[model samples]
Target: MASKRPQSPPISLVELRKRCRDASLSEQELTDYFLPDEENSKPFAPALKLNEALVDVGRARPGPDAISKLYADATRAQTPLPKKPRVLTQTFRRAAKTKLLAEGDSWFNLPDYIYPKTAIDFLGSDNDFDVSNIALWGDELEAMVRAKQYRQPLRSGLFGHFLFSGGGNDVLGSIPAYVKPRKSGDTDPAHAADYVKATFPQKISQMMGFYRSLANDARDATAGRVVLYVHGYANAIPKKGGHYLGGPFETLGFDPVAHAPLCRAIVAQMVKLFNDALQSFAQSTAHVVYNDLRPAMTERDWYRDEIHPNESGARKIARIFAESVRANTPGV
Candidate 1:
């Protein structure tokens, strides 16, 4: 019998940790550690929400009427924006049909099928069918396939999917400032500030862009609603977590010269970016969720360095997001 192989999460956050521990990486350097090397990588799961809503990308097809409705819905969504999901007024079923054919058998390989539409259309609200207004945004089905691929490896069935790889952050440096120290942690605030100022925004922006791509991809592929759940900062994992991983953001207390309000300000910026960038997906019933993690972050449990969390801590954050989407989100 073939030996049973161990599987990895769509995101092997643990593997990311190990690589970081052995090496001293810059914010950008550590980020590269998490990205997908699709050519040599194994398959895994797509992001969480994708698996639930749009499961089968290849075999699924929308009826002709559904395509028209999606266009109409998109139109009304862009204009004065529909506060609720009402029927769209204007529609063009014939032209919509012609556009779908442009993709040929699968449109799977087209880049346009998965990027933001610059803006969402509200005029074609009457289009309740599957096709989008211009057939630009497309992903849900493809996302699911990609997500599963990332969860593991290709041989195991998850290699080509989209993976979360934001050029890494300065967690090694930041965790100490906001978090109280354990034993004798590094009291270097400037190091933390540098991490926050230099690295945080880039990662947040990168992640948001990834989500936008997926959202468009979902619309094109499934012609349905998309949602985002905000899973923000947590209390540190006591000690060693940040130090162990070597990220710059791991809290190390305040340093007189290098420290500033950079950590607080950067986290604030991340929240704004997630909210404002995502707000454009209006018209479509997308939602953003926020919450303070349970078991609360503590100064002690954050690894030995007073930053980063053990698997347990990371789970709490992931859970807030995972549970909310499961609980809310209509017909998801």
Candidate 2:
């Protein structure tokens, strides 16, 4: 009997770039794959298009004809009770139920093929909340705010909460650009601040401004009642296991093994800067809650890779979020 060849998994936009690079897929093929759709035509990666559709489902309002019929029925004679009262009551009841609108990076948007689980996946299963997760893999906070893809859903007045998980990609994903190659005769410092590029601080400040804008928008959209829940990443120990992020460190002349301490410090600094900003925002801003995820997933066993947490870890993070929602929000 002949031996069978090993099978490869299906392809998707999440890792299309890697496959294209390895197989030398042509530009025309990519064009054919994503063209004819206006959102997909944007200059960014193709994966964002998928997220845009997933999260930007506009108001599900009745059509003009349906409205006319409903109006006629409500005003018609011989009708003991008008349908308007019942309809309004139902709408109000639904509006009172907790609905969540989420946007962020890979932690909230990891593909099902890789781990079949994410924080949102677990959170959605919780009884108290209904989640509209629009997170995309490799998304940065700057891009998420600039896109304002959640604006439509937010203004629809259907959601009572906004969940955010960002900043990690803004710092960690851009490591190759933000981290500088060490100089000769330079002793390794206790922190990696000296190794980081000057622009990193400016970038973080800009992201904070965007975050404030988003929170204010959510508040204004819902008449100051929208609760924004934001979470920060746990400190991940850098390892050469995942398909993403780690390669760039080595390419920039920073060896994972030789510069292990510096790598750890870089990640630690990134987490601190991000989490601190989130905590400050939570304390200062109205209707905002920050959940520090570090304490929950401090051990290496909590992680599935260098960056993302495993299923058990995601469950713990989800539990933290659910508890916050239960304690803070008025109704489920």
Candidate 3:
């Protein structure tokens, strides 16, 4: 519904006046200025905050008080573990349509919906992973490969190829359907498993498939080892890190209790999905990865809003993510 990306805080009127006076306005000129800001600006404010938290978290060493402090802080007021209400989650439109998701629908359980608009006037790319490819879809994810089919606006074809055999996709955008509870009246205890079996396996499927497929076309690939990345909140943790990142990250922008807990809950379900995927392979040797953004968000300083980290904070998240992917990629 809302945008995961924050609209750019308005540009300083002084700067605008200066530009207009010198004809420099051309550089900053645009219709519905908010569009450009949303499309191009990086939410570095939170990244910077996380950078500071890295230092705070780094202080905890081998000691009882340190451990106590760490735990105490997690439950405190400023933690980013549970984000505040109604923050928007980002989603790419091309991918949503390609995935054949219904209008006004979402892949996750909550309602801050993921909807990516085409953004005609915007420059650069919607996704960071694939610059060459202008648009993307959930079926294009590299990690969780599986069968696909579409019709008309979506696709009217037979069961097609696996996911992400095509090329790089924004790790955050590639996620398709997450594992949601089967509802109170679910007919079967194995509903999640049966659903995975009967339907086309989603991203989680691609990641947990028997083998890793790094081909050039998604619709023509087989099973593969995927690098699955589950997203947190608007603080949308980065998958890389920077030096002296103040917090455990480079961002400080989420209400952790609202956002972090959801992320953890989502990830926990992901673990279960991985288990189901393992069973599907029969010979099971696929790998999966998960990263949490709560701890750092809890111990950071630039946590101005008790949510998303600052720019430096985001850097910390990215750094940690990069390392985790490197370390645990070979095994589930």
Best by lDDT: 2
> Cα deviation of 6 in candidate 2 (Å)?
12
230-291: candidate 1 lDDT, tens digit per residue:
33333232222223222333344333223334333333344344344444433343433344
Show pairs that collide, candidate 2.
none
Candidate 3 regions exceeding 4 Å error are: 1-27, 30-203, 208-211, 215-264, 271-313, 321-332
User: Candidate 3: worst 10 consecutive residues by lDDT?
Assistant: 103-112
> Candidate 3: how large is its RMSD?
20.8
User: What are the per-residue Cα lDDT tens digits for candidate 3 across 1-332?
Assistant: 97674432344434433433443322123221211112221222111111121123244232332322222232221111111223334653223211101111011100001112211101112232111111222223322233322112122231111111121122222223323332343433233343232233465555533133322122232223223233232223222232111122223322223344433333334334444444344333233233444344433422333223444554555454444433643321
Residue 114 Cα positional deviation in candidate 1, in Å, after optimal superposition: 36
The runs of at least 3 residues in candidate 1 whose Cα sits more than 4 Å from the true structure, single-residue gaps closed, are 1-206, 225-296, 304-308, 311-315, 329-332
Model 2 TM-score relative to the real fold: 0.67
Candidates in order have lDDT scores of 0.30, 0.64, 0.28
Distance from true position, residue 316, model 3, in Å? 1.3
**Residue 107 of model 2: what lDDT?**
77
CA lDDT for candidate 1: 0.30
